[model samples]
Target: MNYTLDFGPVVAGLPDLLRGCAGTLFLAVVGMAIALVIGVVGVVLRESPVRPLRWAVIAFVELIRNTPFLVQIYFVFFALPLIGIRLAPTPTAIIALGLNGGAYAIEIIRGGVQSIHKGQVEAGFALGLHKRDVFRFVVLRPALRAVYPSLTGQFVMLTLTTSIASAIAAYELTSVAKLIENESFRSFEVYGTITVLYFLMSWLMMRAFGLVSRRYFSYPVR
Candidate 1:
């Protein structure tokens, strides 16, 4: 069994795949930003006095977490069009990724918020900080610092989930790899290269998050 391996096609398609990787990164970054916003707002609302708001957030989290992400993206891309709410594939992918990641983020952020002691909240008031400022600075910031690792892990999962965007013909790394495989008829070579690209991108993303955490969450020791 002498099967000669050829990487010429894979090398030729590297530029296209790299461009797709850029698309994947953009989607992930935008999605994560949206997720963070949703997570923070959900946590705030969940802790509010309004029962309806808390229930709404809980429903959203449960709905996303309980369903398949592929189904969610398909609904966003296809079903929305029937309701006269059509979005382009890329935006659809971003929205789906955001909503999916945000659900998990809500839970992660909630854990962090719950970790804050009542004494700390009282201390913020004692320092004459406005309630809003206290929530933002004392509660939110420290809570985020506590949950940064988990949050970044969720973001990485969102990045990987962008692969599902290929189902909607969204421009991303996996979509590009599929096209290359079809054209080159070298499925092994194309997918092998794509696998490496994904691993490298994930590693880089984690490293970037680590740097950001160190810069923003570093605390002075007594």
Candidate 2:
């Protein structure tokens, strides 16, 4: 069978495509923001003076990290309605991404924090620095710097995972591509172009984040 690839349908949909991109970006940005906040909370709880709280944090991390994101999203989107909670598709996608990403990042950040030398903490104390100042100045910055690259990489991965949002009717880039493909009946060309766009966007975001890392975190160029 000879297949003729037509760009007309996809090309004509560029305006709507851009709008879909914006929706994806919005969800991703919100999700990442929530994730970062949760990550910090996770770290704090894990290090808590309260033993039960610490264990709870560990359990939360393990559960979220080990499970498939699709299952989690379905629980929120479909099952939650039974419990009288129904999130809009965009909100659900953003929340799920944030919660999932944060769970993974907690370990990464925790590893970075724990990797800091014990001697450094003692030295800060010997210098008469308050606990807050010591943690903020001595430990936190170094830990974040250590895991900067991993965090950036995760965000890039999240770009592709936004397709899951499409499954829940979030109307992200991939979802839009699906819509276009269905209407235009050009799965090969539509998907081929979508793949190209995904790669391009991921690479560009990675490069941009790399620059930000170098500028803000002082991560060594290697």
lDDT of 1 by residue, 144-204 (tens): 9999999999999899999999999999999999998888898888888889999999999
Q: List the residue pairs that clash in candidate 2.
A: none
Number of backbone-clashing residue pairs for each candidate, in the order shown: 0, 0
Range of the 10 consecutive residues with the lowest summed lDDT in candidate 1 = 1-10
TM-score per candidate: 0.97, 0.94
Pick the lDDT winner: 1
Error of 2 at 162 (Å): 1.0
- Measure candidate 1: CA RMSD: 1.0
In terms of TM-score, the best-performing candidate is: 1
lDDT of 2 at 85: 94
Residue 202 local lDDT, model 2 = 81
